[model samples]
Target: MKNVTRRSALGMVVAAGGATFLAACGAQPQATSGNASESASGSASASASVSKSVRSDYSGVAVLEGYTSKPSDYQPATRTEPSKNAPVPVKPAVANENSVEGLYQSIAFFGAAMEYYMRTGKTEPLRESALDNSELKSILEPEKGTLGDGMQQGKIWMQDPSVTITMLSAQPERDGDAYNWDIRLTTDTGEFIASKDRVEEASSDDDRKTEVERTLHGVYENGAWKLTGMRTSSSSSSSASASASDS
Candidate 1:
């Protein structure tokens, strides 16, 4: 994983992985219509059924884009932003989740946790999620922790960090206790580097984009879906870069 930090307008610090913005931001979500990359109109915004406009949440963490935000909305803060470098805490679990929704949220949760870890050296959200004792946890938790440590001590951050899931689907396992989900994603991410705070987009060859395809194992429990493990199904590197950048 690549390490870099960015700061949002809200005084929140974000993190991404790799040399280019794409690696920092993990995956892109396929929008229902229009190009997901071009459709987002504002800073730190995303394209999904739920609006990505920045909204105040009691939890301090920015409200997820796919969720409906209204003046009447209220929930306990899932994360705490004590300072620009502190990790943003996340709600431990989703509420009233169905299989499909739970699976989707779980995937989003992974990205969110990574972002929080990148900006701040916190893994509480990851530990709180279903990934806690799973294989994915073992694989990513320490890596996230290491990155967070650098951000916290080095004072580096990422900017304009965003993730999109272009495709998602799921099927029940033979044991009926869990579901296997597939996600196709793209990310536009970058970092703030150097003493002068120079900004660097996660770039490879420039004019190219990268897409990742992975499968996640999930189980719905305690009114929410939890991720247990994951496997990489396939990935597109420079071969699809031209097509990806065209989007």
Candidate 2:
């Protein structure tokens, strides 16, 4: 009788132990699964939040979209003037004769001229240069001419001096078939003003970039340099035109 009682007690204890072990095994799997689900959900939520933040921060400007990097192409070659009151260096007379640098400077100034027009919505007076007369006549004309009519209606701000123009090399050679340029512009004034970046490709292609190069016909008008006409480069046309109109 004593032996049977001991055996029965041992059997009861073993059964209870087995039940506890089974319960622990079941609970562990469920808890682990729940934890993994929560972790994944948290990660997904974080990703969504980041995406929303990026979308919200972007301004609805056309120029900001295509700009992948900052402009660091041209370092200051030389400082012509140290004082603000001093006259800036003028393009050399000998260097101005059908030189690539002359063209580059002309194109750069044309951008500034367009900015000036955008602000006033009237034809700015031309500076004297050796540009083609016919080209000057075309943009100066009031009706169909580009510089005359305001392209868009809005307040526009001029870009700061931080704006840089870089000429890119298409071919490996120094004198390649065609050239490319990237213009970076910035403004930190107020909400009415925003930053912009423009990249223009001036190839022989019939594309808009090419049109910009063709249309940028200039002449040396008065004693100062002036742009007679400009064809908007593909990269900067919309932004430049809009900014000019706004100004």
Candidate 3:
């Protein structure tokens, strides 16, 4: 099967954030410098609201940057075709609980939850998964301690996607062993698949980076997309910890 790497998956998430931000801004009144000053004062008056906005822990893969105002430079250049050797799609006896969009949205939340854990050294109640029992247990396990001191201080921006993800591949069944499955996604940023290999980089022999890929099966649960598997690359674990330190 065709594999799209991690960088591309992250890029897709960033693109989606960007699009959401733009739509929000477009719906609001444009602010001038004078308005900015006034807004600052008004914001302080509602410090409670501002404090609530400060989310240190997030549920899914944490993207440190917030959504960007400008468009992203990265774009998808290719498309993926299903393998002829692959098994045919199966219609499960149960109806799907999560839409494709809902699945992506839950992924974003999962990212946020990881961030929260790193920041507070506390583990929140993870959303239960319908796909993999073992994977779900791993995600829900309580932490012995904080991942590090606390979250790093910085504003993470998510860039808007140049395209939208129109299709996602069928969910792969979870066996006792871990396997890589590339899911095709179309985004405004470009077309890409969620692949672990795409974001890996080779380092010196003595300091090779390990990559961990978590799988989250989207299940229709609790009226939303619940992640069934949680994969974390060795590279991603380091990056996530580092992001907390840097923030």
Which candidate should be chosen as best, given TM-score against the real structure? 1
Residues 1-247 of candidate 1 have per-residue lDDT tens digits of: 2322222211111111111122221111111222112322223121221212122222212233343221232221122211232334344223114434334545655565544543333555555444535443322433232333334443334442344444343232333666665555444333323212233443442212234555556654444455643333254231222111110
Worst 10 residues of 1 by lDDT: 10-19
The TM-score that candidate 1 achieves is 0.47
Cα lDDT of model 1 overall?
0.35
> What's the CA error at residue 37 for candidate 1, in Å?
35
lDDT of each: 0.35, 0.23, 0.25
Model 3 lDDT, full chain set: 0.25
Give Cα distance to truth, residue 199, candidate 1, Å: 6.6
Model 3 regions more than 4 Å off: 1-97, 124-210, 231-247
Q: In lDDT terms, which candidate is top?
A: 1
Q: Candidate 2's residue-wise lDDT over 150-193, tens digit each?
A: 11121112121111223232111122322233322221111111
- Measured on C-alpha atoms, candidate 2 has an lDDT of 0.23
